[model samples]
Target chain A: MVSYVETTALRSPAMWFTANRLTTGLLLVILLILPFVAPRYWIYFAGLLGINIIATHGLNIMMGYTGLLSLGHAAFIGVGAYTAALAQIHLGLPFWIAIPLAGVMAAVIGVGFGLPSLRIRGLYLVIATLAAQFILNFVFVHWQSVTNGDVGLTVQPATIFGVSLNNETRIYYLILFAVVFMTWFVVNVIRSRVGRALIAVRERDLTAQVLGVEIVKYKLIAFALGSFYAGVAGGLLAYFNRFVNPEQFGLLLSVFFLSAVIVGGMGSTLGAILGAVFMTLLPELLREGALQVGDTFGFDIALILVPLRETVFGLLMVSFLILEPRGLAQLWKRAKQKFERR
Target chain B: MNFFIEYSIVGIASGGIYALIALGIIVIFKSSKTFNFAMGEMMMLSAYFFYAATVTYSLGLVAGFCVALAGSIAIALLIERVAIRPMLGRPFIAVVMVTFGIGSIIRGVVGMVWGPNDLQIPAILSRSPVMLGDIFIPGKTARAFAIAVVIVVGLIAYLRYSRAGVALRAAAADAITAYSMGIDVRRIIAFTWIIAAITGCISGVLMANVNTLTPHLGMVALNVLAVVILGGMNSIGGVLIAGFIIGWLEAVTGLMLGTEYREITPYILALMVLLVRPTGLFGTKEIERI
Candidate 1:
C-alpha cells in the first residue's frame, strides 16, 4: 500500500492569526456592537445566552471531553451563585473577586460529589450526581440563615471601577468579556496536555491508566474545571438577574444544559456556543409562534405554550441523539466541507 | 414511643409501595443493562390514564385499573421498541439521556392533558384509619401496603420458580449463553419492560391514592433511586428491605427534623453508600477489563 501524508506547520503567530482572522474579527465586532444596536430584550437575552454558553462549555468538558456525565451541574452553579451572593453581602467583595471565589467554592463541592466517580461510572455516577442535586438544593432551601430559606438572596449590582452594572446593557459587556476569556481558556486547555489526559480518561479509564494518564487526577480535574466554569457562570447570573434563588438552579436546568451540550456537538467549543444559542432562542421562538397562532385562531395559548415548549425541547434531544449524535457541530462541518469543495 | 410505633407502621407500609416501584426498575436493569430513568414518568403516566378512565370517562375502578395496566404496558413496549432498540450499542449516557428525554415528553404531555393542578383519583383503598393494638395506621396506607406486599411476593415467587422467569434470569445472567440456550433475549427484554410497567402502574396508583395525583408524582422515583442504590440496582429482594429502611428513615426524620429533611435523607444515605460501597448491599459486583 502506498500513502501520502500532508502536513502544514505555522510559520508565524501572524500567519496563524491571519487564517480565519476575518471571520473571527467579524464575530467580535458584531458582539461588541450588539448591545448598542439591538433591543433591550435582545441584549438581556444575549447576556443570558453568554452565561449559558459558559456553563455549557463546562458541561462539554466534563461530559463531552472527559466522558463523565454529571446530573448535578446546576447544583454546582447554585453553589457558585450562592457563594457570590454571600460574598457580596457579607464580605463586601467586588464582582471580579466574588465570581472567582464562587468558582473556587463550586469546584471544591464538585470534587466532593465527584469522589464517587473513582469507584463508579455511567449510570451509578449519574445517580450520585442526582443525589448531589437534591442534597444541595435541600441545603439551599432549608439553610434558612444562610440561603434565606427559598425566598432567596438579593444580589447587589456588580460595580466595575465607579460604574454599577445595574442594567442589562451594562452587565452584557461583563458577561461578553467572561464568555470570550472562558472560551479562549477552554480552547487552550483542550489543546494542552491536561486536555488530552482528560479525553483519554473519558475514552476508557482503564486504558488511560495503562497509558499513564493518571485517571484519578484527570477525572477530578475535569470535575473541578467544569464546576469552576459553572460557578463563574452562576456568579454572572447572580449579578445579571440581581437575585439568586433555589428554583433558578434545578434539575430541569441541569437537563437543559445537558441537552445543550448534546445538541451542540460534544467535545467542540463551537458546538457549545451553537447549542446554547439554539436552546435559549427555542423558547422565544415557540412563544412567538404560539402568539401568532393565537392571534389567527382566537384561542388561548397560555395553556399549551409551556407544555409545547417542553415537548419540543424533549423531542429535539431525542431526535438529535437518534439522528445526529455528533450534534450541530458535525452538521456545520459537513456544510463547510461541501461549500469549500464547491 | 407511641408516635414512634405509629410512624414505623406507616413508614414500612409506604416502603412496601417503594419496593413495588423499585421492582420495576430492577426488572428492567436486570434484563437490559440500561437504567430506566423514565420509570417514574411511566408510573405517573399510568396513574393519569387510570384517572382519565375512572373519573373523566366514568369507567369505574376495576375497569380503570385494567385500562391503566394495558396503557402502561403498551407505552413501555413502545419505548423499548422505538427508543431503546435503536440504541443497542450506543454509549450508556446517550441511552440515559434518551430516557430522560422521553420522561420530559411524558411529563409535558401529562401536564397538557390533565393540567398541572392536583386532581383526586377516586379512592381505590379505604381511607379510614386502622388501629393495630394502640398504634394507628392509616387505612389506605395499610391496604396499599397489603396489595404491594402481595404483588412483590408473587413476583419474587414467579422469578424464582417459573420457566419464563428462569429464562429472564438466564438472560440477565449472561445474554450470549442464554441466547445459545434457546432463549429469546430480546423477548425477555420486552417482557421485563412489561413487568416493569405493570409494577409501576400498581405502585403509581397506590402512591397517588396515598398522596395526590399530579404531574410531579413521578418525583417519588427520586426517593426510589436511593432505595435502588442502597438495595443494589440488580438485587431483586434487597430493594424490599432497603425500601423499608429508607421509608422509616424518612418518617422519623420528618417527625424529628422537619418535612424538608424527609426529602434529603435518602439521597445523603445513597451518596454515603456510593462512596463506601458502590456495589450496594445485594448488587452484583461489576468487573471491568480492557
Candidate 2:
C-alpha cells in the first residue's frame, strides 16, 4: 500500500544506491548472457529496440519535456549515422571517436533547427522541422561524394583494441552499454534543475520566461541534447546494421519515433523505454499474430497484414490520443495508484 | 524559349493540381484549425476509389467519377465524425498525430485493397496533344488544367455568394459566435471537410491520370505543402498562385540544375518563404496578446 513517492523518495540514499547497483549489475549480467539464452534473431530485435529506446529518450526530451515538436527528428539520426559512417570510412576514425562525432554533428544541426523555435512555435515549428527533414533527405540523396547517394554506403565493422565488434552479439553488448549509460544520464537530467526548466517551458513558455528561465537557451539545449542522443543511437544503428541508406531515414521514420514518444507517455523516461519496446515489436508481433490467425482460419492473412498493421497502428494513435492523452506512463501511474489503494 | 514555355505550361498544369490538393488542406484548416496531414492520403484513397470504380468495377467514366467523388465525400464525413469530432479540445500536436494516424490507416487500407504495386488508372481524358500556337500541351494535362481552373473559380464564387459558404466562413472566423448566431458550426465544419474531400478527389483523379497510381502517391502532398505554405494556409486564391509559382520553380530548377532538384526545390523554397514570412505570403498573421 505504499504510494509512488513513498516507494522512491522516502527510501534512504544508501538503500537507493544499493538497490540501483544491484539492479544495474543484474541487468548487465542478463545482457551478457542474453545472447547465450535467446536466439540470434531476438538479439537483433533487442539491439534495434535499444537503439529505438535511445532515440525515443531524446525525442521525449524535446517533445515530451520541452514541448518542441520536431517532425524531422530522423534527419538528426541521419546526420549522426552518416557522420559516423563517413568518419569511419573516409577519415578512418575509430568507433569510439566516430560515435561521439556523430552526436556532435547531429547536435549542431539540431541547434540550427532550434534557432527557428525562437521566432516560431506550435504548427509553424512543425512545418519548419519538416522542412529540415526534406532538405536533409535531399542532401543525403544527392551528396554523392559524401553519402554515396542511392547506392548507400556499406559500413565496415567497428573495432576497439584490435578486437572487431563484428558479430550481432558484440553489437548487442555495445548497445546495452550505450542504452544503460544514456538512460542513467537522461534520468539524472530529468531530476536536475535544467529538467525542471524544460518542464516549465513546456507547461508555459511565458510563465517560464517570467520566472527568469532563458527560454531560448533551454529550448536550444533540449534540441541539441535530444539530437545528440538521436545521433548516438544512429551511430549504433549504422554499425549494427553494417549499412546506412538515405531511404532508411525518411519522414515516416521520424513520424514513427514521434509516435513512439506519444505511445510511451511523453515526458517520462520509463515511458520512452516502454514505448520503444512496444512499437519496435509491434509489426513483428502483428505478423506472427496474423500468421496464427491465417493458420486457424485456413486463409493467407499475411498478404494483407502489412496494410492491416498500418491501419491498426493509426487506430492505436487516434484511440490513445482520445482515450489516454497522457499515454502509457499515465496508465502505468494509474495502475500503480490502484495497487497502492488496494 | 519554346522549351521554356512548354515546361512552364506543364508546370502550371501540375501546379493547378497542387492547388487543388492545397485547397482541400486549407479548407479543413479554415474551418477546424486542424491541419489534416491525411490530406495526401485522402487524395490517394480517392484516386484508388476512382480506379476501382472505372477499372475494377468496369463502370463508365461518368458513373465512375460520381462514385469516386461520392466515396471520398463519405470517407471525409466519416473521418470528421469519428476521429476529428472527438478531438475538438485536444492539443494541436495530438490532433496532428491523429491525422498522421488517419493517413497511416488510409495508406494501409489502400495497400490492402489494391496491393502495394503501382496500378495504371487509364487516362480518362484523350491522350492527343493540343496545339496552342507554337506550344504543345498533352491532352490529359490540358483537361486537368481546365478542370482545376473551373473548380477553383466555382469554389471562389460559391464562397463569395452562397449562404452556406458565408455561414461556413463565419464559423471559421468565430465558431462560438457563429454558434450563438444560430449558424450550425458543426454542420459547417462537416461541409468544409466535404469540400476538402471533393478537392482531394479531383486532384487525385487528375494526378492518377497524369502519373501512375501507387501507395506512395500521397508523398506528393509534401510538394503541395510548399505550395500551401507559399500561398498562405488560409488564403484560398493565394494557394492557386503559389502552386503555379512552385510548379514553375520546380520545372526551372529541374531544367537548370538536374532532375533531383525538382524533388527538393519545393522544400527549400518553403523554408525560405517560412524564414522570410512565417505566416506565408497571403496567410493572416496570427496576433498574440500577452
Candidate 3:
C-alpha cells in the first residue's frame, strides 16, 4: 500500500516573506498617507493610536509573551512621561535624547518592581505591581517640586533642525515612525533567542528552569524590555499631548492597556496592533452613536454618555474573554486559513 | 494625647468596616477559589441601591436596607451565572479580568442611574458624640463599629458551627470529595456569593453613612485588597486582625503625613507583607509537585 504525506512549508522563509511583505507594504503606505487623506481629528486620533500601540506592545511583551501580568503598567508609562518631561525641562535635552532617556529610566524602575517577581508568582506578583501603581501615582501627586503636584507639566514639541513637530499632522508622522520601529523591533525580539527563552519561562517556569533556562534573568529582562517600550511610548505621549498629568496615568489606563493586550491576542505582534486600534476606536464610536441617539430621542446625552461608553467597554471585554479568548488574532488567522484554502 | 486617642478609635472603627469587606472577599475565595475583584463594586452598587430605595422611593431606612440587600444578592447571582459560570476553568488572569470587566459595568451603571455627584443616604446612625471615658468618639462611628463587630462575630460563629457552613468549608477544601459525599458544590458556591452580597450590603450602607455615596465608593475596595493580602487569601479569621492593623496604620500615617500618605499606607504594607511572607499571615502553604 502507498501512503501520501502532505509537505509543510512552515520552515520556509520564502513563503513567510511572500505572505507578509505585501500586507506589510500596504499598511505602511496607508499609514504614510493617513495624515493627508484623513481629517484633522482622525490625524490626532491616529497619533494617539500610535502611542497606545507602543504601550500595548510593551504590555504584550510582559503579559502576553512572558506570562507576567502587570496591573501597574501605567505607572511605568508615567515614569517615562515624567522622566522625559524632567529631562526636557530641566536638562534642556532635545526630544531625540529625552525619549530614549525616558525609556531607560522606566526600564530601571521596571527592574526594581520586577525583583518581587523572583520571590512571588501569579496573584502575588499582580498585587506587587498594583502596589507599584499606587505608590508611583502617590509620588506623582505629592512630589510637588518635580511633578508640579497634580497640575502636571507642559511638554515642548519635537524639533528637527529647529522646525517644531507641533501640530497633529507632524506629530502623526513622528508617532508613525516610532510605531513602525517599535513594531519591527518587537517582531524581531519575538523571533530571537531571548524571546524563545521568555516564552519558555512563560509556558512553565519550573520546567524551563530544569532545562537550564535562567528564569530569573529572562523574567527581569522581560520587565525591563516591556517597561522600556512603555517609557518610550510615554515620552511620545508627552510631546503629542503637550502635557502630562497624574490622572492620565491612573489605574484605569493600566486596565485599558491590559484589555488591549488581551483583546488583541496575547502572544502575537499583529494582535497587539489590532487590539490597540479596536480599543481606541470603540469608545469614540460609542460616543458618536450615543450623541446621535440622544439627539433623535431628545434626551440629555451628557449624563449617560460616559457611563454608557464604560458599560459597552466592559461588556465587550467580558464577551471577548468568554467568546473569543484567543482574541482578534485568532479570528484573523482563521479567516486567513479559509481564504488560503479557497 | 486626646487627639491620638480619638484618631485611634476612629481608625479601629473604620477597620471594622474593612474587616467586613475583606470577609466577603475571603468567603468567595474560599468557596470557589476565585478572587472576586468586583467586591468593591458589589459593595458600591449595594450602597447605591439603598440610596435609590430610601431617597428616591422614600422607603425609609429599614425597608431600604432590605431592598439594598436583596438587590446586591440578585446582582451577585446574576454575575455568577452570566460572567463567572462560563469562565469556570479558564486561566487565572482571564477570570480576574472578567471580574474586573464586571466591576467596570457596575460602576458605569451606577453612574448612569445616579449622576456623578455624591448623594447623601438617610443616616442610619446618630450624630451625637459618645463619651468613651476621657476620649469622645463620634456617635455614628461608635454605633457603626458596634454593629460591624456584632456582624463579624456572628459570621464567625455561623461558619464555625452551622451545617451549611461546614458543607461550604468541605467544598472549599476538596470539591471532588465534597461532591462524592452528596454535597452540591455549585449550590455552595451560590450560597457563598449570597453571603458575600449580604456582607457587602451591610458594609456598603455603613460606609455610605460614614462617607457620602458616590460612584467612586468602590475605590475603598483597593484598601481591602491590602487587608486581603496581609491576612492571606484563604485565611478567614486572619482578615479581621489584618483589617485592624491596616486601619490603625492608615490613621497613624494620615495624622503624621496628611491624607495623601494615608491612601498609600495599606499598599505599602501589603507590598512589605508580599515581600516577607507571600502566603500572608494565615494562608495555607501549597506544596506543588510540578
lDDT of 1 at B191: 95
Name the best candidate (by lDDT). 1
lDDT of 2 by residue, A137-200 (tens): 9999989988999988999988877889999888888899899889888887867788888877
lDDT of 3: 0.86
Fraction of native Cα contacts reproduced by each candidate: 0.50, 0.63, 0.56
Residue A208, candidate 2: Cα error in Å is 2.0
Better of 2 and 3 by lDDT: 3
Candidate 3 on A75-179: residue-level lDDT in tens? Answer: 999999999999999999999999999999999998887686445666777877888999999999999999998899999888988889989999899999999
**i-RMS, each model, one decimal:** 6.3, 6.1, 8.1
Q: Supply DockQ values for each candidate.
A: 0.44, 0.45, 0.45
Shift of residue B218 alpha carbon in model 2, Å: 1.6
Off by over 4 Å in 1: A1-19, B287-290
Worst 10 residues of 1 chain B by lDDT: B281-290
What is the TM-score of candidate 1? Answer: 0.96
Q: What tens-digit string does per-residue lDDT give for candidate 1 at B81-122?
A: 998888877777888888889888898898888888999999
Per-residue lDDT tens digits for candidate 2, residues B125-182, read 7889888997999888888888897898788788778998889789888999999999
* lDDT (tens digit, per residue) of candidate 1 on A1-342: 110000111121123235678987899999999987999999999999999999999999888888778999999999999999999999999999999999999999999887875455657678878988999998898899999988999998999889999999999999999998998898778777898787777666788889888877888899899999999999999999989999999998998898899888777777788899999998899999999999999988899877787777788888888888778877886898899999
In terms of TM-score, which candidate is stronger, 1 or 3? 1
| TM-score (C-alpha, index-matched) for candidate 3 | 0.95
